[model samples]
Target: MTSFSANLGFLWADRSLPAAIRAARANGFDAVECHWPYETPVLDVKAALEETGFKMLGLNTRRGDVSKGENGLAALPEREDEARAAIDEAIDYANRTDTAAIHVMAGKASGPKAQATFLKNLDYAVTRTSRTILIEPLNRHDAPGYFLKNTTQARDIITKLAAPNLKLMFDCYHVARNEGDVLFRLQDLLPIVGHIQIASVPDRRAPDHGELHYPTVFSKIADLGWKKPIGAEYKPVSATEEGLDWMNSHLC
Candidate 1:
């Protein structure tokens, strides 16, 4: 069976967090994943987990103070301290929530100075973070001038860092837009990929409305024997549960 992670961030954009959890549990999903569950009270999320019987598949640090115009902090030279603080906070959250993975935001842009700071940050984190850290590369369109815009860049940094805990977050929608041959890339990059995500090419909607054929993609995943979560990170065109029917049928 294909285990889908209910992305509460996008799917339940309008609904309250508790309502979204109830909807997902009622839909008979195997599991659930959330985006930035840290924004709300941790105890509320814990209560939801107990009620839904959902296993948290992923977690993430902050994207900096939104009004202050900061997107990421990990790669900025001057803001290394801020990035470290974010990582620590995220680690603590994961430990508290017992979530399996964490995405480190590649904060504001920087030059060689920033790259140096990023390496230092990773090195510092490897010793502290006992759990997994997935380095996400967001699309340039959505995240203008962001430090990490593609998986290849993330792969390179992880290779240099040489930490077993550090790995790539292979988001198909962003990768399909920024680069091609995603399947082959997955084959080549499988060793370093810790998690996966999916959505439409241009619209970032449900997989059923996308140009990509998940049947082929899911088959490839089965063949690869990737024993991890493939995050369903897309906006639903209609009711969230209705949108997932197509994916459920195809995954089987």
Candidate 2:
């Protein structure tokens, strides 16, 4: 299997950012995926990484001030300005972290006008980054109105955007939740998927918690020549390290 990335955001949403980062490194993970590391200063993170030798595999664009009613770009009609700013922030963060990929975390889908604005905003962001921006789908159960909720819709959006600097972030949990044909759809979407993420279905626990066989899935990905890093984006049922016990046993 390829080197897996520890996602501090989902794994330790309740814990302090530095605590989560250190825990991932101590637990033997080689790299991390920072979702919004906005709460923790990058300087401290850099210092911790220098001490621990952990690398940042990727990062996501920070969403706008939600307290100000800017939930996301995909659903906001007049937030193109905020969306452009968010993309610039993500690019700067990626440059600092020395990573090439950035996940454009898609927000809710309000109406037709919102979609039009979302695509326009995405086009603007796409032009800013030489590296492709990843668009991820969140499950409907967790996000009732989230845009790009499945591979089919993500596929359509990416096709319509038609930007060389645009791709997909295929998360196994969301894929399993919305569409259970993980292997088949993976074959079809791999060309567009820049990064992959995994968690147990429904519960978002460690991969071994439920029936989604990550071994076969990962093996298939390996077979398909997907050489990029995959993020372990799961919510631990217990302590984060405790949940990753299966990784030491199953993932080599």
Candidate 3:
């Protein structure tokens, strides 16, 4: 059977992190993931996870200043100190929350300088913790000027680093948008994928809609022998509960 992790960042936008974790448990999700939980008290989040018995599959490093439209710090040449600090903070949070991975966000900067900085930050990140460290490839459409925008680039970086702890965050929605061949890409890149996330393409809604056939995709993921939780990181078309009809249908 395919396992799903409710992305608390999207599912219960109006609720507190603890409440969102409780809701994910109630809603039949196998686990939960977060984009950023630094705003919440770690103990409170930890208590909720303990009570609910749901593992937080992963979370993200900070996105720097939202006011400045900074998507991440790791890839910015000038923000190396801040990037390292964000990594440390994420590691500390993951340790406290029992998260298995951290998606290190690469900010909206590109070029040799940015790449060098990202590699440096990644090198720093890998030595700090035993947990998986993920680098996601955001689509250019959604994240213009983003430093990391494709799986090929991410895969190459992972191969170059050769750090067992460093891996790719394969977000299907972004991949589908930027690369088009979701199943083929999934198969080709499964080796380096530390985590997988999903949403409908073009619309970024529930996986049941849009061009991607999620049932087939889910089956493909299973066939690939992926044991990690697949994150449902989509915006709800309606209320969170109401948009889960597709998931309910697949619960056999």
Q: Pick the candidate with the highest TM-score.
A: 3
Clashes of each: 3, 0, 0
What 10-residue stretch in candidate 3 is worst by lDDT? 243-252
- Which 10 consecutive residues of model 2 have the lowest summed lDDT? 68-77
How do the residues 1-252 of candidate 3 rate in per-residue lDDT, one tens digit apiece?
788999999999889999999999999899999999999999999999999998999999999999999999999998999999999999999999999999999999989999999999999999999999999999989999999989999998999999999999999999999989999999999889888999998899988878998888988999899877789999996789988887889731
Question: What Cα-based lDDT does every candidate model obtain?
Answer: 0.79, 0.77, 0.92
For model 1, give the 10-residue run with minimal summed lDDT. Answer: 243-252
Question: Per-residue CA lDDT of candidate 2, range 1-252, in tens?
Answer: 666888888876677766777888888787777778766777877777767777776777766666754445644677667777788888887766565688876576666786687788788778877876888877778777776667887788889989987888888888899888899988989888888889887788888757688888888989999877688988777777667766888653
TM, every model:
0.93, 0.90, 0.98
Please provide, for model 1 over 1-252, each residue's C-alpha lDDT reduced to its tens digit, 9 standing for 90 to 100. 566777788877677766777777887665677767766777777788889888777877788888988876788877877899998988887888777888888776857887788788878777787788888887778877788877778888999989999988898888887786778888888999988888877789877656777778877887899866578899887878767776667553
Q: lDDT value for candidate 2? A: 0.77
Q: Candidate 1, overall lDDT?
A: 0.79
Of 1 and 2, the candidate ranking higher by TM-score: 1
What's the C-alpha lDDT at position 129 in model 2?
77
Top-down lDDT ranking: 3, 1, 2
lDDT of 2 at 7: 88
Poorly placed runs, candidate 3 (over 4 Å): none
* Model number with the top lDDT: 3
